[model samples]
Target: MANVVVLLLSSYTSRLATSVLLFISVAHTQNTVVFQPSFLTATGPKTAALLLGNTSDISLYLRTVSPSSETGSIGPPSCVAEVTQWVLTREQVGKSAVRVRLSLDKNLRLCGQNETDADCCPKPLCVLETLQVSACVGGTPQASLLIQATIHALLVPSTAGSDNKTVIPNQVYQTLGSCPCDLTFGACDVRCCCDKDCSTETLKLFASHCLLGPFGGQVSPAPDYQCSVQSAEDSSDWFPFLCVQSPPENNPYLGLFYQGKTIATKRGPSFQRPILSAPLPDNVYLQGSPIFTVNDRYFTIPQKVLGRCVTNAPVAFLKNFEVECVTLLHSCPAGAPLQTLPKDLTVKVKNGQGGDAEVDVIEEVATDLSRFISSTDAVASSDERLACENVTLALDYKFYWKGNSITRISVTRTVGTISLNVALTTRYSAVFLNGEFAGEPNSGNPGYQVGLPVIAGIVDMLENDTGSIQRTSINLWKPVGDGFCSTAEKKPVLFGENSTSGCLLPVSGQNLTQCDLLRETVTSLQAALITATYVAKSGNPDYLTMTDWVNISYVTLNSSTSMDNNTSSCYGIPSHQHIHVWSLITSTVDGIPQRDIRAVQVSYSPSTWALDCGGGDVSSCVDPMETQLFPITSSVTFTDIPINTGPPKTRFQINFTEYDCNRNDVCWPELAFPITKYYTGEPYSQSLAKGLILVFFFVTASILGTPWRQIRQAWSCAAL
Candidate 1:
């Protein structure tokens, strides 16, 4: 999974207003404070201090009590209006700027989940609200105030015994004051002090000096506990850390003039490293490219949190202050394709019985061949009457065809005793040829040196019992030679326990025999032509790649044999039936039939053979004999059933009969390999060939066509 990122921005402002009333020979400062015009609640009806700033970098600090004091009915009896204040701050050369704003905590309102009353219930938990104060300035030495602020009762409540108390419940609060002494622009100190224990001596001094006479009486005394409050809406209230210049200006030092500040740019003060910051802008890390080619939208803010309070203008006494925005963005990365393992293989075998038999046969051949002998030659005879007794036979043979040619042979056999009318086993005569052991004579032909090794069984049935004799049941062992078992006169050979390593059909059972040692290996050389076609149709190599194609060849690639010699190209024997299989991965699900595909061609040549014979003693020597080889000139094409289109489930039906070139007497219901494809997603769907039948044929044709094209071109030129 990938990740995503984003950005946001946050800023705020604060301001104050005031007035002086002269009546009956008295002059007094009557400060009315109001917050901004945009806030989530009302800010009024509470007691607070009204501090005024003057031009000498000084602030005239004063305290004012609300008309409805602690003993009063909470507010001005008949006046529901909020008292707005003009904030005045002294600038250089006796100039002062006046701005309007609401007071702190007292200007806030309350809320309840179920309360519907306009003044009391169902209020906003927190909202940005504002109030504009009427502008006013002081009569004394004044300075133009570039910025102003109104602090009110929304401040955290002071302990009851202390002056740190608030009139409104659940309201945010703040306060306003200036540097008590000469100070730099960002060096003012602010604090919240509990005024519960005002000294009588202090009150007496103020009254004697007439400082407390302006309000017509001695006012409530202030407290001594103090803390700093964060005004929610002030960018300067919190010193900024890193400031990115707005449009029309490219550098922070440029004083709103689109150029660098003369003094700050070249002087030592430079720019004060900002101490606070606003929030980030929005949509900074979204993916724009390879679309827009650039990502420039972003911002960053810094902040400190003190207990539950926060500050834009944080005081040195504050240990923790928090900065935050209403919304934030999360960052993430890009997308890419995922790789996974393939599903279960769709393997299949044409004949379940034969397939299992073949596996067992191969295992035996690769493992133990001597034990395979008894199981092969154990087929029961057709007409041996059952006498409730067992029958057995044994025969042995020796062939001396030393140079891969014709040679003489000898054989012998012994049969167990048995009654003729019952389950009979006969003793067999062992003939001798020139003082050498010959095979047992059968009723059909005497002393026929056939290789049917008998191990203790019936010798002769009768004249009419030629059924058993003709079927090679009678033993007549012989030797291996070129002319011994010629095409015109085929002979049976005992090929069970006595043979080197081969298949055998026992007389005790009806199982088919397997020839193990006599086998061929091949390579699929023409797979390139076949695979390119598949690649054009499928993008992924796993589906139809040449590497996955099963290669079928009659000759192993790196075997030690000449192209025209025996042991090469089907051992240079044109008469030998050599075949290759391009197996198909089939769905093993039941009820699917095999589909017919392409036809295979077997090409031949009698020019590929060599033989030699000689003795190291120089006593004898023999010339080589002839051998033939089959070569294919053209490839075949297999067209079968259509493939499945959708996912989750699919079935396949293949017909081997459509692919078979030779129609033999092998009997079965039919011959085909059936399978199904299991699909999980749209892109993984695939269509494979039916089986080895048609595929091999098409491959052979393709290999042959290449040379044929050149030959045809040459012939055409000669004729011209």
Candidate 2:
């Protein structure tokens, strides 16, 4: 899961000015998902209710629960009360479900206690925070979930158990299933929970088009909604990539530890090889070119889609941010109150576009953020929605306490002036038990026995196809592929060779050779993975001269003999397994020449699922391993590039030719080549004569009842 996410992110992010900020909003129940018409207008202080239903067969106990302040709310919401008289009482012991009513505390005010204060409050926008809850099965720590919650006075309090509905955002809805389409066929009713846009026509269109149509099967390109994200003044801020948090001074991957790795570039500062590796205390090798941000320019403003209600409403962007101060309160403690960092954070927001202030980092704002309020009316109408723009970034700081040393630096990103990077900073509480920064684990095993070949193939995606500039990783698994780094070992095929691990895709062995990941082509995948890296490695400043595409066969096992269905391993599994991959990078800027980047075409027959159970029957196949990439071939190109001034405006396009993997998409396949159940360290015979000898030996062993132990010994002796 982690590796896939990282690869998908890193692969598609080359054209981005910076890396994307990955904010994982974990969902609890069907109720905790993203829903449509997500934004709700709040006129004033109001009550919001949440009803949690546990479908587990056993009694479930609700323990600690609350809304984390990461939502950027003006005040803390007490789960106990909706009004003066009523409190959240249903959250008692041993109940399958419970209803909790939340309301602003009597003393809790959106604006400061003092009305004249400049930091009273910023213009209000409907913020979707999380409803964090801890549940226990029979009081034995079951699990915790973060349910999505929107705080607004005008929101219709969702009745719990509302047909087990969720507020999945439009994207999430499409990902989960076709909304109105599924709803029409009764396959699902996800749209019923959407911000109630269901008209008679919408329903009819959904049914006729989705279910009852001749062109129905599932929409090709999923539908998009008026979804929006918070806007930052600069694209870099919103899509955090770089970092003030210096790379590991001892890590060799970033060339930081390579004391003499400084390579002089044609223009600008000296550069070094940006590859992932550990430091070598003895010596170092360096010199690789990469694209760095010559300059930065702000892009689209961040926003939260408010449906068609405020479709044409004015969108605001942050002009600049100010951090009055950053305080070191106390040592970390479990469940202690969160004393907000960056003593006073404020944003100077403006309507429409904002000017570039050569934005980097600022210490203090003119006034406190609480005082950064817009002139929008105190009352919000259904159509008149507020675009509460907040640009959150990261900043590094160190504090000394009474002559003592502070080695590990604690990080913060919410509010205040701070340096931002792609790393996941602290979100909500530090306690993992409360489901803080919670996420779904990527651990699934299918029955098709896809084996390790597909796993290796997937891991190949994490190769060091680094662009000149690299984004810091924030996903749960940052050092992507760390999970598989040493998960398995590859035995040496030749007698004198040593076994190697972590080389699943390349399938490390004496046979593994320098078949360059980039096969010198005009369009190749590895280059697209790191366009900047490709630019540097290409050695051509103006033109990427690896002209013309190359036709390369699917990477094979590097074996002398090709074992097919005609032959099988001792375990009755096919010795030779094939995985098809074709990744190409090609692009043309309208005004610029098209002599940059490279491409490689890979062709191979789609493999079949190595079913372990039944005789590979489609129905009997439990967990199917995909034998081919849906798009057996894929390409990415950057177009309409503005090279001169202004930020590089690149149109990134991916030509994906989909194919059937093992039939359905339910099963995910990994690389299992170069890996066999048994290790013989003996190469196969290429000639028919040698092949016959090998076949005769196997047949003789089987007929004479020769054990595996004796067979291995005989093979070893023959090698000797």
Candidate 3:
């Protein structure tokens, strides 16, 4: 009996292996059926009808192929297959014969027992392995087509290392759901009525206030003239006669004809270059190419555009530029990193083989940290908050390059103490030098040019050594559009343009204190104006002379009290100042004009009201506390003057003769000066000859008048 059982088991195993091999062979031999024009028009006997066989065989095949173990009895198939049909119509060529084409739809339905409810059967119980499609003419079958179904299943491993694992089968179908706009998970969004997190009580607060009237705040569709119609106010009178009748599944292009063949179009090249995210070991640098650091990141610098600060602006190779931005520094220790410049720079240089090679250069940045609090110190250590007011924040970078590659770099940073909510100007400038010695830029060629900033410097006269003077660039008041008479930024004055800017000076305190502070502030502002200054004789500093400076003359009202009210006269404050700049244009012998600022005059005008006590004493004035605005204006004028080509001559001596031009009989005193021509010949002889001719014409005109006519009349009478 044991021998017989062993032989039987061996035979069963062999049959099972043969069946598995047969299934694989059938799957491979089945060709993919692709519908095409040739397949329908080929010369062959046409099929009249197509039908699918019973699906019970497919369920039995799946059960035979499934694995079983000794731990459990053989179970029914997990899925049962259902048939899907597709019908097609075909026409025979050059004949009045109607043919039928048939194909098995790839999608199949499966039904199975539900795990949650033993009695319930859910869809997708079994996967289809193979199906038979029969071609029949009337009731008799002519031929049959075998179709192997492709099964897609997701296998999930059993956690207990057992055979009890799940396989999820997927099918192709259309699905519908509500629009998803509430992206946030736990929290209820404001004005988002569709958010599930919004409870009934919370939704009631903003249900009607939704931005898009609920519906997940989705945008509404635009009005369509063909599909949308205006409804009448009274529903009883509304009619659909003029409304468009469209079906739910209407095709927009139905019944339209398409003629021309489709020609594929290729896109044009893009102007933007790809930014490098990783550093290149050795690469050539090009203009406007993104710069990279040694680390795998693009090099970025802080920049500002349209009054907004951008911290991640990528640095471009071989591009020299500057930017000014306003930033708020809250605390000293927190803003220390911003005050330091970038120290590591990755540059490209020319190699021995004439190719560009990239190298990393680390330089020490000049940093000033005395103004900021140390990171180790506590914020409450100081009594007063350390705030940098009206301080300059500058970042300067100098690059040394050979040909198109940079060889070296230098960076400098000058920052002030960080403050809370303070708007500070951050300036960045870059200079590229081909060689060590680079000359400074001039404002113009030979003289000051219009639209260019004026070159002005403060002159400090040495008291002991009167002949020596020290000159340094001075900052002038520049309007920053904050407010009238408010804090301003210092900038150089531009030539040839007239500008008026003012700032508010606060005068708040007791009577005496307000008066003193107001006077002091006015004095300081007036003193800060560029008065006695040294300027370059020409735009180019190479031609500067010792006497290149000019003193500013102040024009004031002829009053006993000074403009600053120094004598306590209680006079009105000089709140308005106008500076008049005069440029002298000297013409050379060749007629080339040379311009230089020869005179600068400033005038002061008092305000309408005086800040003084009723007794005319400014020291005791305490009427009100207010802020005063002081306006300063500057204008430029150009004068043309001839250059003295010859040696200096004495002034022309003239004898004055008193004559009354009011009397008709008396002739006015001869007041004429000789014209000194620069390029023309003498004109005295021509003038005298013309005067003699004019005298002769005058006498002829007199003779031709009354006296000559009377003499002729008397002679005629004596002859008669």
What TM-score does structure 2 among the candidates reach? 0.15
> Could you arrange the candidates by TM-score from highest to lowest?
3, 2, 1
Give the least accurate 10-residue stretch of model 3, judged by summed lDDT: 1-10
For residues 79-195, write the lDDT of model 3, one tens digit per residue: 432334333344332121122353333332222334454322244322333333333433333333333333332233444486877643221111122225576789888778767
Whole-model Cα lDDT per candidate?
Answer: 0.24, 0.27, 0.46
List, residue by residue over 34-147, the lDDT tens digit for candidate 1: 211211223232212222222223333222223345665322112122443423232232122122222333223444446565543233333223332222344332211112
Predicted candidate 2: what Cα RMSD to the true structure?
35.0
Q: For model 2, what is the error of residue 157's alpha carbon versus the real structure, in angstroms, after optimal superposition?
A: 88
649-684 per-residue lDDT for model 2 (tens digits): 334212321222344553223132123212234321
**What local lDDT does model 3 show for residue 531?**
44
Using all chains and alpha carbons, the TM-scores for the candidates as numbered come to: 0.13, 0.15, 0.36
| C-alpha positional error of residue 621 in candidate 3 after TM-score superposition, expressed in Å | 10
